[model samples]
Target: MVDRPLSLYCLLLPSQKMIHRLLTTAVRGLSANYRDVIYYRVKGGERLCRTPFAVFQERESGKLSPKARAAMSPEALRKQFEALSGKKRATYAAAARKNRCEIDLRRKAFKQASLSGFSHFIKTTRQWTDLGRRAKEKCCAETEKIRQAAKVERDKMVEMYYSGNAVKH
Candidate 1:
């Protein structure tokens, strides 16, 4: 065995210690970049990022009558959306970001679960398939034996039938 020297920049945790990494946009972005990830403690709390899976953008348009903006064109709609983004943007950007990150995590988790389920089904069914094949072979062998016996009995009856018909002739 070769003795490897540890680097000064590396700090390793014990084997028994488990650190849970919460799903966050920061984490996802780091993953996307394929870079080493670091996380700062959340503001005012030690809890990591936990959020809802859905997000909806709040429309910032004022309560002006729908009668005015009903026939707006594409450019006009963009302008309206931009105007809404500037002034009345909701304070939920943080929550929405967290929710989006959670959605990404959920999608990843769901995909993993689906793959694992399919693999498990294939493994379990393989045994049943083997059992079914063996049973079929046994049944076919037994049926062949019965058919051979019936053929032998039929041949004996044919000779007896001919002997009785000879007396009638």
Candidate 2:
């Protein structure tokens, strides 16, 4: 049997067991590269299939259909936004603000963690006191500042959402 790279379409068989069966029977004596491709393609296809909408789309057009494209366009989105009631618009804005705040907080925390490298050292030594007073205090102060900012943002988001007010910025 001639060894050829498997098509992605072949891996899209209805059942995973079918792919496994094909691999076991047809992939024997194949080069390591071919086996690896089959393994990864099957795994990747399985991952894609987990999302039903994506699987349906793939089975249909393998790309966004015209209706999907139109629905996702900027003008369509603006029209959809315009159609929402005032209260719903405020709620959506609040949710977006909250999401942005959370992402910013996570980024700040990650930056602080990387800069301090204190967590790694603490984990290894199991001794917080091993860090010098100045470094320890600085790290604590920075972390506190980030926490306070996040709390303030969260409170503001909740207030705006409940009050049905749009942020003026």
The candidate maximizing TM-score is 2
lDDT (C-alpha) at residue 115 in model 1: 33
lDDT tens readout by residue for model 2, 1-169 = 2233365334434563354345434543545533322222232232122232333333434356778765575555566567768886666566456545544553344333333334433333434444588877876676566556656654554454445454333
lDDT of 1 by residue, 1-169 (tens): 1122243112323321111111101133324211111111222212223331111212322343567546545476555545655323343345556645743543443333323322332323322123466665664565455456545544443343334332110
Task: Please name the candidate that would achieve the greatest lDDT relative to the true structure.
Answer: 2
TM-score of each: 0.25, 0.31
Model 2 residue runs over 4 Å out of place are 1-66, 70-72, 116-169
lDDT of 2: 0.45
Q: What Cα-based lDDT does every candidate model obtain? A: 0.34, 0.45
- Stretches of model 1 off by over 4 angstroms after superposition: 1-69, 84-96, 117-169
